[model samples]
Target: MTSFFATRLAVFSTLLLGGLSTAWLQAGENPDPLGEKTGGSTTVYASGKNAFSFPLASLEDEERTRFVIGNSFFKRNWVEAPASTTARDGLGPHFIARACASCHSLDGRGAPPDWSRTLGPEPDATVALLLRLSVPGKPAAHEGVVPEPNYGDQLNNAAIAGVKPEGRVEITSQSIHGRFADGTPYTLQQPHYRIVDLGYGPMAPDVMISPRIAPQLAGVGLLEAITEADIEGNARAQAAAAGPVKGQVNHVWDAFAKAERVGRFGWKANVASLAHQTAGAFNGDMGITSSLFPQEGCTAVQIDCLAAPSGCPAKGKTDKAGKAPEIDDDTFGQVVFYQAALAPVARRQAKDPQVLRGQALFAQAQCIACHRPSYVTGEGPFPSLTSSKLSRQRIWPYTDLLLHDMGPALADGRPDFQANGQQWKTPPLWGVGLIESVNGHQRLLHDGRANGVLEAILWHGGEAKPAQQKVLKMSLAERQALIKFVESL
Candidate 1:
């Protein structure tokens, strides 16, 4: 018995030694999680003790509940029929997918074609379906070339083929490689797109293409709850704290209100409100009518739009209300409600010793400066988002919701609302870890080029270049710890 006990003790000692050695080795190879190496080492508290929890509170207002239902209506792959068509309700005349959920499954991130296996060899078709934009000249002044009328920025990949394709789009990718400040090398997958088979003949070869991947939808309701004034305040504070890292909100026209407003939706901070966003989607993505966007998208060059079997009916027809026909506003409103109410998932607790250490490193490295960890939302009609509950409430979304210049490496050379080329809204980090499980792909960033989250960070430039430089110098173990913390979010 004594001999056996001694043997067990020896084995335990060997395991402990091995563990330490492994950790030491890891410290040499991983990307820095805190985005840099701070000379002073500090201890991080374990997140298991102070993790954020997801709340499943009810939305009490009748109107708000109805909105939630509408937003979620397309959460599955079903599209509602047009108000006039009772027999066929879901398939669209021109659409990227049958429903919003098809692109943003489970309210999670989207993957690019290069990273998608289910899309098969016909990835170009999917690429054409992706959005594209151009400015027509140098400097891209705000009053420059407007989005192509009728066709807009996106090309409808799926169409009632015989009608008109909003125009065919093509996508191509280029691989780029770079090294961190510490001499660590990384590779990024970047995309280049072109519009082909234009009904109006060829477009200029120099027209800029910007591929967009649909982002996750969780906690958007909370984002919406953040007041415009508060967002502006945060931007001002960040600019003061760090000169080059400053951010700004985009203000644009609100089609719903027929007035200028602060922009919050879209990759380039274009659309101002959920109501306008829904209306735009109905018109551009699905070729459906909505109260805000009342016209059918017709290209002057497409002869078929003037021919028979065209989805639009004869010009002078009167509807039941004795007015021109359009998509029902109430149905569209419901969909917006659903999109604005998705709750954030619970965060992983930071109880583990390694995670605690990593969190401390994260703060010290200045990552929290832009990825602001908490915000208090204003009161709203939705019970779950009311000011009483939102005011001073601690929520960890990890985004400032402002635009920043990301440099030429990530630039698409397209202007959106007031954002110039290379500008993008800081995406929220909540539910990022489950993107693969929910969306079945691991693509990251605006174009879905990054093979992994690490790749995405590595691709950062411009305002985030300093943070990227810091990350390159971290020990492998420290980098792993940082990734672990992000996963916990």
Candidate 2:
């Protein structure tokens, strides 16, 4: 027992040196109570690059093999329907990226059009960025938000060959500048956009638009494993705390359950479970029908889109009925398994004095009120949710998985389920530090408008306005510390 404890302590000590935070130096003794395993025993030690794309360390041999299989489908591109390749066909009559990997771009966060800041023509060329549209009423009866009459819920900027792309996304922008308490200045770019070249005619005049960039997928399964009860408990604690931020549950459709459940995924917490979220992405982002979403994303006005060659229809109809839904349960299950199995990446430099100060400053600014530091996920029912190592382990994901008003600066002015226009979900912070290495950019926030972590923090408002103000008043050194601390997580 003595030898075992010493060995454990030594392993934990090693983790503090490389797994806790950015700039964490090797401590004289073990410092992390939970040790270096941020995602329990499933934590993967990777940084500088290729950090967001590894399987959990504790995943067993069969599970790791399964992860690789799922990854293939996640990265595979789907072609148009009525093609030689039936398994991968049924790409959008109207959709965005050809494959899941395109938007996610290596299982990581996406940015607004890369060409938006370039000197090239048609600067509004969108890649991973997606625009969600809605009106004043609920079209699905149960769904609170209504789809734009012509373009449906999402504006598919691209279509399969021989189909008129719904319309291209265009953005007009302006910049606002501000000075830190110490007189350091920064500029925030605000964007205004319009839909040009409407293939399905004009959208509803009362259309409400929301732009979302695909977020990183690592540790998502761990987040899902956090029980609903614990999530609400966090909300209760925040509501009773000495803070203005009050995060509420966003109950959204659970296609798998065929019922409404507390949403914990998406920018608005509009997706209930990984299954529902993945199925929705298959249909909404790629126009591929699954058992959960049998319909194409096309609206009635998109006559060409509806009439386009499709192996899978909203209803089960086609010469090959087996392929009508495009993605079968087995295939989608593998994809979800891969996403759920992607290991949480290690932290860097947690023991550094500067990062420690920044960590304290983050809590002092009340950012921790909404972005809760840690969670010990519940046990059992692990498939598509958690692994044994990821279960019941204290992990530092830095999210409450609840909806909070983010203020007008970040508002999409669109309601998703119970998420008000000004509300957004607390995004997880794991793998954030390595975004630059994996995706080659550091853009943050729902629309990828913030140039870096500082800008993202500065843009916080509404329930987070107080924290934003606190950060605004912080000295330059404190601000740097806070950002470093967050990046380390």
The candidate maximizing lDDT is 2
Per-residue lDDT for 75-99 in model 2, tens only?
9888887888777889888777778
lDDT of each: 0.58, 0.77
Weakest 10 consecutive residues, lDDT, candidate 2?
117-126
Question: Model 2 Cα displacement at 157 (Å)?
Answer: 1.0
Tens-place lDDT per residue, model 1, 272-387, is 67777777776665555555765555555555543413233224444565543234555565676666655565555435555555555565456665676655456542443445
Q: Show the lowest summed lDDT stretch of 10 residues, model 1.
A: 36-45
